[model samples]
Target: MNIFKRTGKMALGSRLRMLTAKFTDDASSIYNLYNIDMQPKWFPVFYVLSERDDVTITEIAVEIGHSQPSVSKIVREMAAKGLVIEKKDAADGRRNVVQLSAAGKAIIVKIQDQYQDVNDAVEELSAEANHDLWKAIEEWEFLLEQKSLFQRVRERRKQRESGFVEIVPYEAKYQSAFRELNVEWISTYFKMEEADYKSLDHADSYILDRGGHILVALYRGEPVGVCALIKMDDPDCDFELAKMAVSPKAQGQNIGWLLGNAAIEKARSLGAKSLYLESNTILKPAISLYHKLGFKKVTGRPTPYERANFQMELKLG
Candidate 1:
């Protein structure tokens, strides 16, 4: 009788909806058994308003990951139940600010212990699934934030079709492209340090002339990506993969991969025995890509850049 369960993976969305409905129904039953007079769907918005008083509907929507209209509807329901109060913003009368009413505050005190019990029950249920459902859900949400489902599907479709994303060795003509690419990423994530300015302003003398290598990626004849292999002062044949950047418009097109591989190949050609890089943990997508390319985390070392929190190395094979 459960059509979605019969369809298996083919009905992922339907199955997920069914699972959510089951959980919601069970939550409703639990509330009724405990004499709690709140709906499961209103919990997110209610919790947010409880913590942040007198916030606008837009703020509640952002905190709860719902649309403003959806949050407004929840607020209306809570207001009808005498659980929330809405007031017109003094500065902007058009905006409606929401806060928990005295009844809602009292109810929170009444249901605080039950909330913890419900969370514990959720953990127990998740544990019975034979996999880390909470972790899986977290990863899924992270991936969705990195790229929407529709965008990822479209990218895969484009990858199947013929396209031109070319990685070329550094040329004198691409001097500005190299600087612009690196500066764009560096400035966005971290501030421009003295070393960054040195490399960006004098790529030829600081990098190319000093036996370092730079690779540039071109898409449709426009320079869209670049990565550098900076020769170190150490005695060993090691290179630092640094200053990698891809244009926002050309991202998700494998341009970073092209430039990264090209940089590694160039490093190897120049007798590099080990490749290392300094990056921040905030760059999750970039760090994931580096891991896929066989880079592993190593102990932290003193670095000139204050933003560097992670130092990873890839042993050249």
Candidate 2:
């Protein structure tokens, strides 16, 4: 039984690695046949050097699609074998550049016939397989760069998990969840202050009964995210969009985003003119999310929370 064959696409990386091992072994034998003194892994660096002179590791990395550290390590290995030389860039005293040594140039000259033979062999192999592998690889890389595999999987995962998310108005049964969710996030980032406990402890009184609203997000009928449109006593803003929290497990599913937009619409329904929020600068993603929701930074207002160094307001018409 072949596990890779059975697993199919799930084993794509393993299958590619297996093929690489076979190809590398064949490359080693081919080098031996031509009396070459270089390893297959070092060929990329040597090929770049053969075409150019006085290049930095950054240039080599960009040319070959490899990382700077990997290129530097390969350069060091080649230097140890006396096949390459490293020199300080005359134009830039602080930086170093690499070029092929005399022996390296000799190796390229020796491999000219070998390169021709290898090219012919590859052409024949591609013809026999009826597949242009080089072109296919380029197309595959372009598509992956446009949208990474992680992003693709994340979208699919969200689609699958969203079936479990539900948004509902506040209920007495959800009091503990309302407090716990806020406490979990606040304790993780900053200290729990008097304002947090005041609203979280008795949300119905501190927020709801005072002409405010609360929205609860239920994942599989359990509270996973919650936010409040706390009515304000001030004249400028009608509501404070605060106490927004999402469970760690429910993150990446846009649960927080859904709740935020819901709260905004809910505030509008209640005839709100503007919305205000206070958050810490350390919560960069939260700040970014607020900005995306049309919230702009505001100043000159005193905050009640100890962690409120950043404030934003959104106008609702």
Candidate 3:
């Protein structure tokens, strides 16, 4: 029987349980194949104690989300293995302080290196699949949290206080406003070239003609920011993120994030598996924002566009 089928009665809980089971099974299989008994659970406890050598056993338990008795049992086992050392807490004589032994510290480093193999296997999966998996996991977590009474009330209050604006296709009427916002915000923010500022209209036109769409952030009937997705002709290439700019007046209001997220959503809607953008190092905040949004650096020169002074890409599913 499929492992999932064994847990089918519980539906959502079953799926989660099955996932954990699969992970454990896979890990055990790998360990057996390598003729090793590297108990994965102990690694986290070792890691935490290694970082804070003087931490109390209770602190280790709390950090690793284990009960005191469970942690104590593991600690005693590890101590017997000479992987950890415990001492009476100096300030609180009743408490036992936990620290990694030399063996434990060395094993943690080895565990990290072996874990890189797991990371490599994960990275081999298609970017779209990884993105979808993470997105589904996040949605599940959010839905689970929403089931809590306190979370439901908190979400409702947040929605009531924070006004949300829908993303709409950019129109010609908003083009000038977008341009003004770009020049006012981006140029000043990044110290962009004057020629770069002058070339946006033509570049934007080129993108729009190529099955691309721009969304302007509107508040009170005024365009506050702009973001766009330009379709890539190359099937192997991702859609390009273009014309992302927020009004200077709206800098701290997360307008840039809204615009960037809208561009990502639009790119996904267009059947794009990834999104790429051109940016400069001078735009540190923008670069930081892109990194925060999961963009990674690529080893190549920017595309032959005036605004593509630098480049970054984010996988989308």
Candidate 4:
């Protein structure tokens, strides 16, 4: 019924639950269509167990981003189904380790093609949305471990209710703020490449003088986020969305979204035809934001940074 289209963010939890149920039911149907004899919910734990010879329940929980108790329950079901074997860890008798059984291995081997087909289908579905749901879900799970959903909600509510976030243009004194903000996100997900250092350390020489623009988000008059629209010398007068970050303290404040919208407007004001960005799939939130701003995936050219695997661009005019 397109619950997402109907409810939007007003009923996020309910919409997500409906979508999850739909996906799970569709996956089960696909397995049955392929003559596979496993439920869709078992794929995550089974896939993790298949990758390693032996792993503890806690380890599986960490790897699959599931709660220990939830993983243990799945393990018990799989063990009874003869799909997995659980044994006491030799080093820690209190800990129980698990592994895929011979039967499970045989079944997986038989359904390998089906797995590929499912993944390919998922990719096609993701293309329709212009973003990968699997990647988004995984990254969200990673973030939930770092900060709970309730905590993020409280922080966002406080920020919105207080109206402390303000978007402003880059100033000379904000050079250090720019560098620090960019470094925080890069160091968290990737190392700062030489290109990053060159541009960030000298914004005037590498960006401003080259007809680029930078925007900073201030929280209570302190620079808390930054994003840049870097001008390119190509015939199209392109702008690369680059060096964007928000301070951890100012996260959940919609600063990134504010900075991104500002950059897009700046690019248009500069007569840029399109905007490009390079990023890793692990940075799912960032990629999702780009998609939300009308960016679409494109084949990336050779990149100077090691972490860039996904490339996307937005048309301005």
RMSD in angstroms, all models? 11.4, 2.8, 17.0, 15.5
- Tens-digit lDDT track for model 2 on 215-255? 99999898999999998899999999999999898898888
Please write out the lDDT profile of model 4 over residues 1-317, one tens digit for every residue.
57567877768788788789998999889888887778887889988877886899888899887899999889899888999998888888887789888998887788889978988987788889977788988999899889998887887696673488788889999999999888888988778789999899999999999988889888889999999888876775398898889899877677777788888988888778899888899988888888998999998466788899999888888
For model 4, name the residue pairs that clash. none
* Full-model lDDT, candidate 3: 0.72
Spell out the clash pairs found in candidate 2.
none
Q: On a 0 to 100 scale, what is the lDDT of residue 123 in model 4? A: 79
Question: Candidate 2: lDDT of 65?
Answer: 93
Summarize candidate 1's per-residue lDDT along 1-317 as a digit string, tens digits. Answer: 37765787657777789789998999899888778789999999878877888899889888778998998899999999999999988888888789899998887788888889989988898878899888999999999999988897777855752168878888989999998888888889889999898888999889878888888888888899888888888764378899899999888788777677778788778778889899999999899889988899987567889899999998896
Q: Which candidate is the best by TM-score?
A: 2
Cα-based lDDT for every prediction: 0.85, 0.92, 0.72, 0.86
Quote the positional error of residue 84 for candidate 1 in Å: 29
lDDT of 3 by residue, 1-317 (tens): 47656666546555767688988888887756654445656666876876777787778888877898988888888888888898888888988788888877776656665578777876676464736676777797678775964565666654542365445787778778767776776556555565455446654556677677878887555677787677777665668776688766656556676678878877777778888888877788889989987889875743654555678888886
Off by over 4 Å in 1: 1-155, 158-162
How much is the lDDT of residue 185 in candidate 3?
65
**Runs in model 2 with CA error above 4 Å?**
1-5, 88-95, 233-236, 268-273
